[model samples]
Target: MNNMIAPSILSADFANLERDLKRVSEAEFIHVDVMDGSFVPNITIGAPVAKAIRKHIKGIMDVHLMIQNPDMFINDFKDAGTDYLTVHIEACTHLHRTIQRIKEKGMKAGVSLNPATPVCLLEPIIDDIDLILIMSVNPGFGGQKFIPYSLEKIKQVKKMIGTREILIQVDGGVTLDNAKEIIDAGATVIVAGSAIFNAPDVEQRIQDFKSLML
Candidate 1:
């Protein structure tokens, strides 16, 4: 399989977002990290910004909701042009319903797990999800170290979703150093923040990261 590189816009220059988005055109999708103070202790953009982004970028918007009540905003996000809407398994009170709601809106539903969240917790609901986002660092921030244990988590989740055709995604601390390792461990999609957005030559960095997937 050809691995995917998704550059997170959280670490990009918010003032010139379109320019930054253009710089990472090689990316399979634009990874948007939505954080509410209650869920991850940080506040970021919501529906309006997401809508504006959709109008400017032609790539897929893989929106990750790190908020407490993802169900409350699922419809809004889908309407805002989110191609894939992922909610934290820990945040949703009714994961199946939320996933069903996302599909009902005609978007792919994904399940995201924090670094401390166990992979086994997904066994019961794995069949309902289109993708699984494994956070290599805690959800609140970006540019942190890729937790070594996430590789094992990816392997286990990949195994659990066997023959179901679920895509496995890894977010946080994805850099050239370990991009290959994560893919080798079974992640089809990789989300990078500082490694791609903060690089001196942003476009080259994306290509360099993409090369590692080979």
Candidate 2:
């Protein structure tokens, strides 16, 4: 499996988003974080921005829905060109239906969990998902400290997905400091926002992260 780097758009400058996206389009995936104040403490972009981003980015749009009632908007996000639509398990009351909706719309379905959420919650539908997003830091913000327990969480999820082969994604606080540890712990994809966008050399920083896994 490929060790991947997904640069989160939350840290990208809203003013020069096109330019910033162009810089990181070379990475594995372009992560779009959708936040609603009701679900998280902050509010970020919605369908309009996602549609605009879809026009500019060629890589897969890993849309992370940090919003409430994600199922209601899954089709719209898919129409907005989200290659993979991930809904928070804490936010979805009917996870199976949402996952089915995503698949029905021809997009890969993913489930995300906050730091406090348990990996065992996915046991019933482990094979139904294409990706599992593990929040290494608390959601709603970027560049926070990587939680120590996240490593164990990744290990647990990995064992669960064994042979079934679902991609394990680690988001938040993903940096050179813990990239290798997380990947070794069973994460195939790493989503880094401030770590990449805030770096002086975006491509070089991504390369540095890739080096650690190699």
Q: Encode model 1's per-residue lDDT on 124-200: one tens digit a residue.
A: 88888899999999989987999999999999998898888888999988889899999999999999999988899
lDDT of each: 0.91, 0.91
Residues 1-214 of candidate 2 have per-residue lDDT tens digits of 8888899999999999999998897787999999999999889999889998897887899999999999889878988999989999999899898899899999999999899999999998897999999998889987799999999999999998888768899998888888988999999999999999999999798888878767
**TM per candidate:** 0.98, 0.98
The alpha-carbon lDDT assigned to residue 125 of candidate 1 equals 85
Off by over 4 Å in 2: none
Candidate 1 RMSD computed on C-alpha atoms after optimal superposition onto the true structure: 0.9
RMSD of each: 0.9, 0.9
